[model samples]
Target: MGNIQKITPNFWFDNQAEEAAQFYTSIFDDSEIVKVSRYLNEGQEIHGQSEGAVMTVDFKLNGQKFVALNGGPQFKFNEAISFIVHCATQEEVDYYWDKLSEGGDESAQQCGWLKDKFGVSWQIIPDILPELLSSSDRDKSEKVMKEMLQMKKIDINLLKEVDQA
Candidate 1:
């Protein structure tokens, strides 16, 4: 049996927590919605409006916990921090790249870095990155790095080819 655990990430949305959660869960495997609680009647009122509404939501993405809060339009997702998906083949890279890039912008970088439509950054990298970095040939490693810097989704075969050259 699976052990009891907690996986949580706090996400601020402009009244789109549910929508975003559903969208995210749809894109990933081994993910599902855990619970959603809307506002209820609390004896207190602020500005003639209910003080609490959708205080919190718990969802899971690939066994990771994420908490979505209906915090007003105070902050938004940026590229400062991003989720990295390590892939072993071009097929894996293509799958994630196509899925996440939907309704999002794409920026190419060395290794891997791309900004999705929601302004959230993602790095779709290959499993061979470490191998290339630790190669004995500094020139080949440098070349691989230079080539990677120009790509959004890392291509493992391409990196290997660069390393060989």
Candidate 2:
């Protein structure tokens, strides 16, 4: 915990940096808001945001460093980059899926992936997914993949059942 992170993931949000940081910190354990900065006459004309408005929020999610920037809407979050939450249990998956997907675009959810209210994409995947998918049995892995593709929230129990089928 004392060592500094080498590379931090930065998220660009359209005026929701503080809110998003708070939301994420509240959901994750050992998380906290470290600092916050405001825009003060820097790139004002291009950014088009008011002075003194929140420009950045530095936070930690489960002890991992992350930055949330209040950048303008020049860029939008897409499937190009997403954070995958590797859950060890079905309960963890359910909790994260339910919490992150609240007030988010439900229709965008597919294969344990969903876009949060702030438009950030997240994958609430179970830890057993990769193990089962990489199994030597092609038929079972294929069935697991097939079932995964058809569901919004992943059903680990169903995947396990199909893996043994």
Candidate 3:
């Protein structure tokens, strides 16, 4: 037939695929759970998940397709990969940062990055972040980068203010 219709990012969880997908779809707009499939005896020999247990959850977050797999805990989520929540305003950034950081590792928060309770890293960033950090004026961009390094959630106003300084 045709080429691959979509590229779905798969998330591996330790029996928390359903929970993580629900939480993610709830946070983002225009998102929803498409379907869920439970484990069967087909390949339980390796997975070890009991029958009827969650196997996969297909979902959409902010209109992006994703799949959550209830894989065992042989692997862990680390900072190597992170989802970026781009916002147009400070309020949007704050809202996402608050929700994503809830029940998360507070110590892991830095430079607009935080790990959610499920250990998934997220970057709550302003839409103009790139422009601010790549401004024609080196001083402005450098200062913005420096200021950003000291904060947990991104501070759009602070970045703008520092840009002028």
Model 2 lDDT per residue over 43-99, tens place:
888878898999999999998999999888888899889999999999999999999
Off by over 4 Å in 3: 1-5
Stretches of candidate 1 above 4 Å error? Answer: 1-7, 41-55, 107-111
lDDT of 3 by residue, 6-75 (tens): 6779999999999999899889999999999999988888889999999999998887889999999988
In TM-score terms, candidate 3 sits at: 0.94
Clash pairs detected, candidate 2: none
- The TM-score that candidate 2 achieves is 0.94
Which ten-residue region of model 3 has the weakest summed lDDT? 1-10
Screening candidate 3 with a backbone cut-off below 3 angstroms (N, C-alpha, C), the clashing residue pairs are none
Which of 1 and 3 is ahead in TM-score? 3
For every model shown, what is its TM-score relative to the native structure? Answer: 0.84, 0.94, 0.94
Task: Specify the highest-lDDT model's number.
Answer: 2
* Superior candidate under lDDT, 1 versus 2: 2
By TM-score, is 1 or 2 better?
Answer: 2
True lDDT of residue 78, candidate 3 = 97
Ten-residue stretch with the least lDDT total in model 2 = 40-49
**Which scores greater on TM-score, model 2 or model 3?**
3
Best by TM-score: 3
